[model samples]
Target chain A: MGITSRTENQGRTIFINVTERFDFNQHAVFRKLLNDAKDGCEFVVDLTAAEYMDSSALGLLLLLRKKAGNNRVELRYVKPSAIEKVVSASNFSRLFDCKAVSPL
Target chain B: MSDQCNTDGSLNLVFKPVSRRLALVVDDEPINCVIMQSILEKMGFETAIAHDGYEAIEAFELLAPDFVFMDVIMPHMDGREAARCIKSMTSGRFTPIVFLTALDDPEEVHACIEAGGDDYLSKPVDPRLLRTRIYSLERIRSLYQKLSRQHDELLFKIAEEQENEALANRVFLHAVSAHNEPISGLDSYSRPASCFSGDLVLSCRLGQGGIRVMLGDFTGHGLAAAIGALPTSELFHAMTRQGRSIPELLTELNHKLCRILPDDRFMAAVLIDIDPVKGEFCYWSGGMPPFVYKSKDQLIYHSSSGLPLGILENYDFVSEVGSGRLTDIERILLMSDGLLDVRNQEGATFSSCGFKDLMDSWASNDGFFSALDERLDQHCQNRLPDDDVTLVSIDLEKALAVLNVSSDQSADLSPEPEGWEWALASGGGYLLDHSEVITALTDTKYLQDWPAEQAERLQTLFGELYNNAIEHGLFGLDSSLKSTPDGFHLYYEKRQALFDDPPPGQIRIQMTFLPRQQGGCLRLVVQDPGKGYDLTRLSELEQHDDPSRFWGRGMQLVRSLADNLIIHPPGNRVEAELRW
Candidate 1:
């Protein structure tokens, strides 16, 4: 009922869609999805369906950055449908370039 | 002792006076002497007859007769002369000498009277008159004996009481003499009404950094009031030297006093802890007069906050702490109620309000205590005080450096505990009571040797870490959720709900401390039975941890304080190590 993801271009680019709550409970599922992403691939973490996201969800995003690896991987972000204070406070817009268009 | 007297002040006659009531009769006239003997013998008196005045004096000394009848007109030495000599020989006794007068002449009777005769009995004595006179005089003699006996007993009782008071004074002097070990910045004075004082002034250097000064006044006065100080002083000295917190000291002292003292007795006290360097001051006052911190010329008053010790069963005592620049403080004054209640020759008291005037006039000077002493003495002079009084002043100088002297505070420091753990059910609502947690930690043998400050820091650390594991792991209350206005409330409500009926999970903690040659280190591992967090994220936050960055506040706190912090894979279990 929360998050779903799909791969494209032989997993070179990944779109991770999150729905409902993206709190700590989704950490394991999110981890598996990010670990399988190819190194230096483009990954777009979509939180458009997420109604709520806690600090652990932020932790997951940081992990996603590592699994994606290297600057060439290009960690992109899709803003949640209901903008969370956690996102604004995390400076994720600037840190992961979530607010601008994906460079890749 | 009979007080009944006949007309003309003579008493009624009695039957055979005891052998100890022997009467001596002296007369040169043989018939007169025989008549006197017959009368005295009939009245049950043993009679000693002397023919002349010289013989009368001789018999008076030898027999020490209770009654004497002297013949007024006698040869050799006259009756009057012998009576005078005999009276002096009797020392301080009521041995009465009655004159036997045959001649009906006023001059002769008068002469007999001047020579120490108590009354006159005419020669050829009237039987009734003689009987009345002897009975009345005998009544006076016995009453005098009884009064002398009582005087002797009274003297003895006084000596015994004085000796007991002196003993109580000796013990009291020794007990309160603990104050004699002068505190560097503190000047104090105490005086008792009687030989014993009921006040205790205690000040000591806390091993860490601070001076704890206490002035306690026991209820009432003298021995009963001073008795409580013996135990109070022992505990105060021991605890203050070890540098225990004021709350612990108060709670333990209050508990012991309540246990040992009768319901009617209690101690009114003021306890102050001053960290001169840090400019921190904490105080707990009960029943004593309000305290005033004199800074510059201003007087800031703080009223007492609790009942006197030993009165409450389970006192919820709290100490008030304040911080200000130490250089601003002039002096700190503490006093027992006795100090204020002391009165002058005119019966006017110095009053608690007088301290303000004292501060205004002289607190900044070196002669502050002397000025105060002069004021108290001027008020009371030599007039006895009604209570025991104590006053202490602490001048704000260079941060009470006297306490910086490093004493071997933990001479018998308990070795670090080997290993122990407690597993409380999630349903235990108040299992994590901070005091209980602190007690549990301090109860360890190794923790006992740890300095109080260090022990306190660890208690705070454990509290934070354990709480995080239970809340974030077991309860799964999201930290980021708190960003919302209602999130904190909602999180607490959910937490309380879990306390009543918690999910199937357990929080287990194991601790292992190792003694290093340098010092020691403690390793604490806490685990919760819940889906663990991703460790890669924990390291991510740790790498670029910004304190202002909100979410992982708890983890940030735990990681920063601990020397080595490791969150195992499946992040439900975390280990932290602290080195000392």
Candidate 2:
């Protein structure tokens, strides 16, 4: 499962809604989302529905940060899945700001 | 005439060239020039002629001959003087010159050679010797050509080997990543050798009890070192899945390596188990470096393994290499010799002392694993390491839960719960080690409160649990054997006999923890394949609560401490549960 889309305006903030599993199988999906980032806005990655993430997926995230370049596109991880412990082990919190979003 | 093989494995040309380059025949007499020219043409070489020594020198420079045949008897200048001048001009270059002389005296012949003539040919030159000399020189040139080609090939091969080694190193890293697919709570970094460095690290679960880590460095490098890794990894993961004891696993490993390893090599390794719930650590080492346990204070405990594998044919490893107790919030440090031997820019070794101090400094401030890795990289000056380096740190704080409760909550809560997860952890006959049993208990949710006191009780419970399962369940020992002194002696002998011929039956121990409205409850059931026990006397004795009841002490002690103890069995199973 994957969420390949741009950030939509949610009231005062613009956030990207992720509604599927992120893995190595979704190479094209991740590549497109990274290429299609809009300019001049803080973006929150809403991971409220993602159930799994592999190392390749994590590696894609790092590549996305590099691709963002001077665009100053800050990625915020919101609502990480309980089953996915890779986030804590890799210590992504130190590299990126994470804020949990309540379940709908 | 045809010539055979030269000394340097080459053949001399038989069919001479028809249009061979011309040679100048220089002499004072026109008659001698004519004779030489006719001979040269017959030998398939073109000829040029000069009458006097002065004319010969002028003609020599204008038309450079491949070789020259000059006569000593000349007008303006002798053959000696002209030869000296020609030799000087062509010094270091391969230009053959033979002297043509009518005089038969030794003195004249010596003078010809001293004047830089390569060889002396009498007034009647031998055509056979001329052909042979040209063939020999050509052979020298061809030999040099072959040598130059081989030299170029050798250089190419070396470069190809280096490129292949780089690619092999990348593949080894991929293999490690595949083995350790998804890691949590830590970021692992490894750098492998291109050719083959036997040093490797694996972090995973050991029997679902706790996180298990293994750091191994084989005897040699390259393909020889990596062969053991395949089998070692297979055994490590297989035993971990079956929940086999490290001692038992080590025994299997030892036997396997002894049979497989070649005469010259062996494996040195370390195995570590860390329980997230109990925050306890257990480890076994086999001739590996001592793993350091770091505390908030400057205290460090070193855990070392016993022996390397394949040393003995039939070896029995002691389950515990060292004391296997660990505290919560502690950091365990593991490393290979690569870290200790890392040389600085000034060529000084980064000794163990330096490593300990570095770790202590970081651990004091509760440094994360990433920070520690970064500090190590900085210390090495960001240069490539000469030897392999691997380090793993497990934070005890993250592994344990520290919470306090008020009186109302404390009163309502019980140490053991009612219905939790029921698991049957059994495998190969090697789980007798106290450390293995402790780790298994600590991994379960029921034993999360594995304080020093609770551990002591668990030690007793395990001893009884194991003995009862082995003796009564597998060996079918009667409880009435303790009734008389004679019976006790006979029972001891019978136990030994049973061990000698051990039975094959599974002992299933199930434990559950349930959080009830009033308090939590605990349930334990140990089932065997044997017939059910006679519980009529035990049920009657439970009402009296006598301290000195001979037949029921084991069950009585369990009943008194536990809120509920029931014996439901035909003859083989025991089910018991305790609340608080």
Candidate 3:
């Protein structure tokens, strides 16, 4: 599994999705997605399908926050419990708005 | 060739001659050799003739010809055999061989090719087909030469780059680990995913009879991640040598990294300082996994509550230090997150629960590190880890022994300089912000030859005296405010507020070193401008039996560390004499 992204709301918002493993392998693709997004657009990272994440992934999120501005970036549906532990451990909540939807 | 006319000129044609190429003709029949030689000479190549296989090899070696025409049938040796011999003599250089065959059989043509004949012609070879074959083979030979030359250049470049990387790695390793002290109780293992490790572990002997260890993991693995470690290690060793506390060291490290590193990069680290004399352990963790302290009966984990270094600026950075009694801990284990993130073949991680289970299964502290190493290897099935892995374990009793022996080493008894005096006056703002002044005061060129322990003690003595004058005399902050935990926080807060816009006052410091019969003595004097307090209160507080009270401990420490102590009238001046 890998990273994918799409635009919505007439290109006003971009939704980037990460699946399975999220680590350094995704660095170039992630930065390219951030770079391609329209300026001043809201960014939402969907990690619902992610099973593992590393510190490099944390660094990528920090980079995204820096580009998207603090209020415009949000982490949606951080799930599988394990990834959420990393999110909290790294104190990402202080830097971005994170929303986790419980799996049924 | 082209003809051109100049201004006064007649028509002129120019010809540039090409270098002649040599060809060899091998055949037992004189008629076949003559026919091949005539055609090759018509194509502007000079020719050499050989009778058979043996003669062909000799002629090929002697002439170093550009190409060869071989006849299939011969007297002593066949044309195919001669072609094979000539091919062997050419080695890596390409020399085309065309066989002259009368037989129309496909098997004979295949045999000619098997003998290294590049192509073949009929008994009466046609000049036009011979020219086409020569032109195409010459094109292939030139291409091969170009490719071989480029291959050699690429190999040379790669070798040069590898040598440079090896040299840089050597210098980097020395800078990172040369200052590390070999303490008895400290054991560590580091395995980088690549040639250079992003993880760094440093251990330094604190000046005040203890040890300080730091384990830091940068953003990624390999050379890019390893770059930040140079500054971190340099700062850690330099500040620890000055006997600075963990918070002060962390503050400076954070500020330095923040100014240098990019926004996406930061270091996750855990630092532990163990004071053997006080029987205490203090640590600061930032964005790293929890460090575990294991006793015989219980285990304690200190988790990180601060952001990783280089992420927050100096004004927003807060170092949260946790402390506990050394008696309660049998061993302290610290690791990078990479250890827990190790994955098996099935993609299952060696999570924290696995670590806990392993710790629980250990019956005793003996060989714990070895056991953990074996377990990790078994879990990963000998595959190289995806991230750099580091683990450190410190045994309390052995660490204390190392510290005791180090402090007990007798100072060098060499004669000292006759005498020297240094003095400085600084405003309250400068004193509050720069603690390096304490180090500078004690680290004069004259004292450079003193034993490390003596120099460290003088630094501590000066530091305590300097903090007293600024915190109590200049700022007028009450020591009673530091008795309770909340008040301790408040006291620092008030101190920081006062430091933002320091009050108008100055403190004077003077130090004098004098050589004595046995060793030497240092006289330190610090004067402030505040009104004096009751001198009797100091002795009363010293007699009090409350060990946990934070107030009055600085004065007690000063008194114990100095051989003679005096407070001048008005309580604004303090004098201490330390003898070696």
Candidate 4:
């Protein structure tokens, strides 16, 4: 599923909740979700429940970083699946956010 | 009892009928029955005689007589009882039975039907109608047998096809089972399609220098995909053992596949070479995912695949396989598209952002594979994967180093004109004493090879070339430039001033070497970039009239010095032969 919402309580804290599964069929839906959520909100995506993610999923997150004005989303991945790990390894993590904790 | 034969009393034991038919005559009074039998036999049926109904029943059971005329008034057993027994024997099947009645009573005819009779006639029965009915019943029986046989064969064929399909599925499962395991690579974990995986991962050492690693994903799964694996595996194993370069192996694979693979089939692949000693890695990508390398500080580099092979004929991948040197403790990760394109239960990707954070946090504490497994497991929540997945990783520090010494040295030297090999033989421990020889040597035709403005660039080049000839070629010196410092500078300065002017110098040069079609040679020849010492002296030097003259010494040193050398037609010019 895809992560959708983010809100900043203060300059120090941010929260991001899941929105939808970022898959081939839902690519368009996921894109709209990201666009709507990225209106100057600082958040970290909580992925404790998402079971699978693909390259396109990674692409959308990259788009989120760009949309967050100065790429300051400060998004952190809480948990990632086996497939997510592979997508994460592809320089995306190096580009913006860092993996936080693997809840599994 | 009467034995009669027609009207002529010739033993008269048999009755003959005018028509070609047979009739059975059964009677206690043989004489009366015989006459009746003859009368019936005259009509059309063949006839036989029986004294009692018991004998008649026996004949009917054995011969299956189509038409029977029985006497209701028979000895021992009655005709009505015999008819009932015969009817019971042929129940539910067609057999026309006719009964003979002495009395024309409707009640008697009804009693005969109850005895399983089709029709009854008076004592004087009309035989024509009986013959017609028997013929019609036989025709229907033959038609029923033909239709039932055809239906049984069709059912058998459909069952056989179902069994074969099941057998094929079993074989496919076995092939994929071999690769199924708990993986522990950069991104540890595996996902296959519908339990029948088509993507393949292979690792083997290539020759003595490099380790060959590859991941291949076919277009479709099951039988459509299985066809490509046999060739893919065979070529990969063979080429890796032969130490063929990735390009060569890829080209070979493409050729073989194009010849046999169906039009719809194709394969996307990524090939890698990791050298532990050189700390270098080479990658030849066809159409896989973007392979990445993570630095100790978390900096990332991406190497994406080119177009897949076997998609087009004679398509060449010309660029050098991309390569990089690894830093200490760095990690290199490779993956296929399946992992990147996965969607979760809500139809959304795990996303690259979430993936990045997960990796960066765990990158330091755990191995890449374990961390990958833990992170993905957390994100997916133990859901099944929808696509095929593969991941590969190599430790940066463990990867070997590749040094381009030939290119480095060539950059320092200069190129000579076509078709020349100039060998310089320098002497003395100090280069100062050899100034005149250096100046005279530089004045030869060789200095004229390059452009005038590039003279300074030629200084270090000529210095190396001259020193190499004098120390290595002449004195058999084994000192390498990398190892020697003292001789290097002296050699540099001597070479600097030599190319300052354009002059004529009869420097004799020669060459002797083997040349190849695809081979080339580069030479750094040094000579005075100036006019010759004198035309007469040059002519005399060319003539070599005085072998002992020091003025012609440069000529002699160069002439016998190399494989082939020529002072240009202009007295001041010198040229070296480079087979390349």
Among all candidates shown, the one with the greatest TM-score: 3
Best by lDDT: 3
Question: Judged by DockQ relative to the true structure, which candidate is superior, 1 or 4?
Answer: 4
Model 4 spans > 4 angstroms off: A1-104, B1-188, B327-329, B365-367, B381-383, B396-580
TM-score of chain A of 3: 0.89
Question: Model 4 lDDT vs. the true structure?
Answer: 0.53
TM per candidate comes to 0.49, 0.42, 0.58, 0.35
CAPRI accuracy category, model 1: incorrect
**Each candidate's interface RMSD:** 26.2, 15.9, 1.2, 9.7
Chain A TM-score per model, please list them: 0.78, 0.66, 0.89, 0.62
TM-score of model 1 relative to the true fold? 0.49
How much is the lDDT of residue A101 in candidate 2? 57
lDDT of 3 by residue, B1-580 (tens): 1111222132111111143378888888788778887767765677899988778888888888888888788778887887877777777678888888898689999999999999888767777667667667776777877887888898998776666556546655798878788876688977666566678899998875578999998886555665788889999999999988888889998998887877788898899998755567888888888888886687777887767888767534334788888776678888888788888888777874367766664426657767777888888888988888888888665665331212221123222446665555556344433355654543446577777888778878888888888888889999989988999999999998886776867676666777787678988888887886567897799899688787888888898889999999988899999898
Error of 4 at B455 (Å): 49
The chain B TM-scores of all candidates, as shown, are 0.56, 0.47, 0.55, 0.39
lDDT of 2 by residue, A51-86 (tens): 655434555555554454433334434444431334
Rank the models by lDDT, top first. 3, 1, 2, 4
Q: Per-residue lDDT of B226-291 in model 2, one digit per residue for the tens?
A: 567667777777777687766788899888887787633566678877653233566787655577
What CAPRI grade goes to candidate 2?
Answer: incorrect
Root-mean-square deviation of candidate 1: 35.0
Best by DockQ: 3
* Cα DockQ of the candidate 1 complex: 0.00
lDDT at position B264, candidate 2 = 35
Q: Which ten residues in a row have the lowest lDDT in candidate 2 chain A?
A: A82-91
Worst 10 residues of 2 chain B by lDDT: B401-410
